[model samples]
Target: MKSIVTADGYHVPVLLRESVDGMNITPESVCIDVTFGGGGHSREILSRLGNNGHLYGFDQDMDAIDNLPEDAKFTFVRSNFRYLKNFMRYYDEDSADAILADLGVSSHHFDDSNRGFSFRFEESLLDMRMNSKHSKTAAKILNEYQEERLADVLYLYGEIKQSRRIAASIVNRRKTKSFKTVSDLLEVLEPFTGKAKEKKILAQAFQALRIEVNEEMEALKEMLTQALDILKPKGRLVVITYHSLEDRLVKNFFKTGNFEGKADKDFYGNLNTPFKLVNNKVIIPSEEELVINPRSRSAKLRIAEKL
Candidate 1:
């Protein structure tokens, strides 16, 4: 039982014990932590590995570099997990024993006032690129996207009911004053904010913009598809997802070997799938953990083994 303390509260790994345990790591197993935000989960994995074991940590954010661990067995890949297969091939590794992906945004991103991940900071610029190098920003989406496209993002990604109305309002508002900061967007959203669910609604709106700016869904699909090719027989795939959209994708892929989640029947009527579900029921943070880390309340962990 190893305890990992993040550097300056960069991120507190959610479901740390269950996620790692699900990996079923051996003393010489090779693993990859795709969402290596704070190195909390990666450090724990390293502690359980022997000298022969190796762990690769992937992160697109420049801030994650500061949290890299000092260990010979660990390699830090400063790239997005969408490029997992490419990097693995580049390193001459044919397959991995286990792969872990914690898809929640790090606390450090929301806490940083300048990153525009949180609407709590009124004056913050609407720049939600996980990798700062990305050209698209939340402000750009709000200012330039067509009303119909904007509505689709809000409705499909954010699950907002008033997406069309909101999109119309944004286009109308941007014509007079282009959205540059969080406050500017907040002003346009003022009408949509309900009395009780204001915070949740605002959070959803921000999440949609962030997803669009980062192309999160496309990346997740690509990474998951590539993961199947990279995992060895009986290799473990442990994922911790925060939102329903991503959780659904992971659940579907783990159950049916495809994003559609359709179960095909064989001659004996048995479902044919490439992976076996490790936990039929999704793992979630315990009540004790919830009290300690409120941000982890929405996290759900799912594990699968390659067949």
Candidate 2:
């Protein structure tokens, strides 16, 4: 399959069928594709739908809107999935039969070295905004964040062991000259943690900045809660997460309302479970798929049914 370019000018198609398989849609089902990156998954879902079915998609990046299918069954919601409930109100749809989210960076984003997603792209501007229209950029977070706040982002989001040290180095270096490009920042942090087995220390640092610039976690949390609420009873919720943090959040919330909790029971023994997990275990891409698309290596697919 040739890569499809998203309206945002990047190309990527990750976990196409695997992500939508859990949806379990019917001809009349109304599905929501929350992370409409390249519309690859949207195309699959649309094909699965009958003439009466509807597919609503959300994407914060305006460019993603270009990929929207101009059909009665499909609609492009050009907003963050965080505000899914609000958008649903506009569509007069309170609940959906299936909701799918593929949490990841699109090929369009990474291939464009200037997006600052890849560590290999050194001279490109340190701009990692998924939606270039947004005012905040990764450079602002690195150069302007307080050392403590910066450390928190790196530690919590990136899980960087030496978050404090890295943040301190960034702050110190910025005093004389501000960091403007990947090369500028990567060079300074390399000494602290030089090339090793992976030699992708630059990726770790870049991930931290990208996560902060997008506020990925916060938006994810909001989208999850909203999507669950808008799910019809017995509605299928399928999510494909790229990293452990996201997988943990999805897994924990599906198993227990909170990430960490046992099934609580009252004196009458009513189990407190918002949704039931259809797949007791997480699903990963098959080896064949991995060989074809290495990016799917980190992908984890989980499905749950609304109670």
Candidate 3:
């Protein structure tokens, strides 16, 4: 397949060969790339598909539609993968041969400073909506949410130990001025930043806000549930998650075929699961790829097949 990475600097696919190859796609296979950020994986899937095969790429971000490859077999769905079943049914696909989802924010989000996915832009708006059309913004959550609720967002999503302290600081500061820009939030995070692990702490704070703004965990659960329904027997399901929260969900789902991670039991006490883990261990980016793309350092790829 031709390189999808263009001069304009779109996303550079992480774990490219590992992710695409994990799908086990054949010439006649019908596949789906649930988060077609830069069309890298979608393009690779298209290359393996024959004239009779079809590939669907789904993304709620309208900007991603522009990156869609102009191929007859490729169909770009401008919607979240949570609607996977609905779109698959609309297209009359009873089941897909393979399904792939690269979870969390894309490199494009961080690269484009205007998007507010990174802390690099102090004056930028706290608008971290994956789909710009969404109503909620990160600023709103920080300003309007109750202190306890804000603490939960930070503790649960960011996994910060001092979530309560952070939330208290945000609420107290926002009383004087509603947070409108990154600098406004950073000012409150002063005590947390400027330390040896300042970047990590700030990133966590931003991550919690971004995840809440986008409802990412909720969306991932919805999409994963629908994926099982759409995948054919023995079909491959590959997921690349960036954070431990999302990774835990994928790991539990792949193990027990549900989010709770409770293995189902049959009459004979044999475990019954819809999918089996292809890679028993998590796959991380190679040191070489890490050198080339530092953003991929946190990536963890997990592959499973429907039984």
Candidate 4:
């Protein structure tokens, strides 16, 4: 397998083999790789495809392009997978045989101090744009969100029990001065920070901003909507998610086509939803893989077939 990379060039792979194995690829299938960080997973998927098979990849970070292998059967979409429906038109059919997504930040993004994805880098810029051309920045989220709303994001998205204190700290500081980089936020978060504690907090804070900036949750819903409609009957969807929010979204959708799964069924007593779960249980990394790549610890793999 090839190496993993973040859009900014940091290298890490979350769940290397489990994700691809979930795809159930064949020589004749056409595949789409969403969140193509580092192209490690993409290369593995491509290896399974024959010359007649095709691979389509999407990443907002242009840096990921350099890592992509040159191939005639491959197409790369620079836009977010939210537009996956529109972009898939360029392929053999609007529908695909299989779809795979290894979601969340890349190794490159976390490792690059300049990008500031990690609390580990205090001196770095707070600019967490996967696409730098994108207007919203983490700094803006800190500077702009209403205190109550900000607290809600921290509480709900980041799961911070002390979200009130965190929000208060952010708002109070930003009023006196504009926060510029990762270090700026770290100073305010210093009191509550520790290795384990810091990771959860930083991930949550980063998630809220990244979601707002990239419209990630919305994009995911859109992709799910489009995917359910476009995938051929029995076509497979293999997803690897790193956080509970993402996992919850996939779990609900797989179970009920809607995240809440609250829809009422018809007289015939069917699922009222279209998805038929292929892997009824969510898949986790094996002990061996987890030992090698700790990042896979949080990874959750879910699979379903179009119904």
Model 4, residue 114: what's the lDDT? 81
lDDT of 3: 0.88
Tens-place lDDT digits, model 1, residues 123-174? 9999999899988999999989999999999999999999999999999998
At residue 234, give the lDDT of candidate 4: 84
Q: What is the C-alpha RMSD of each candidate to the true structure, in Å?
A: 2.4, 2.7, 2.5, 2.8
Report the lDDT tens digits of candidate 2 across residue range 33-139.
Answer: 99887788898899999999999989988767667787789989888888999999998998899999988676677777767877678888889997788878888
Number of the predicted model whose lDDT against the real structure is largest: 1
Which one wins by lDDT: 3 or 4? 3
Q: After superposition, how far is residue 89 of candidate 3 from its true place, in Å?
A: 1.3
Error of 2 at 172 (Å): 0.5
Q: What is the lDDT of residue 224 in candidate 4?
A: 87
Expressed as tens digits, the lDDT of each residue in 1-307 for candidate 3 is 1112346667778888899999999999999999998888899889899999999999998889779899999999999888899999999998999999988777667767788888889988999998998889998898899999999999999999999998999998987899999999889988976789899899999999998998989999999999998898999999999888999999999999889899899999988998888999999999988777777888999999999
Give the higher-TM-score candidate: 3 or 4.
3
Q: What TM-score should be assigned to candidate 1?
A: 0.97
Model 2 RMSD in angstroms: 2.7
List clashing residue pairs in candidate 2.
7-63, 8-63, 10-108, 11-108
What lDDT does candidate 1 reach at residue 300?
91
User: How many angstroms is residue 122 displaced in model 1 relative to the true structure, after the best TM-score fit?
Assistant: 0.8
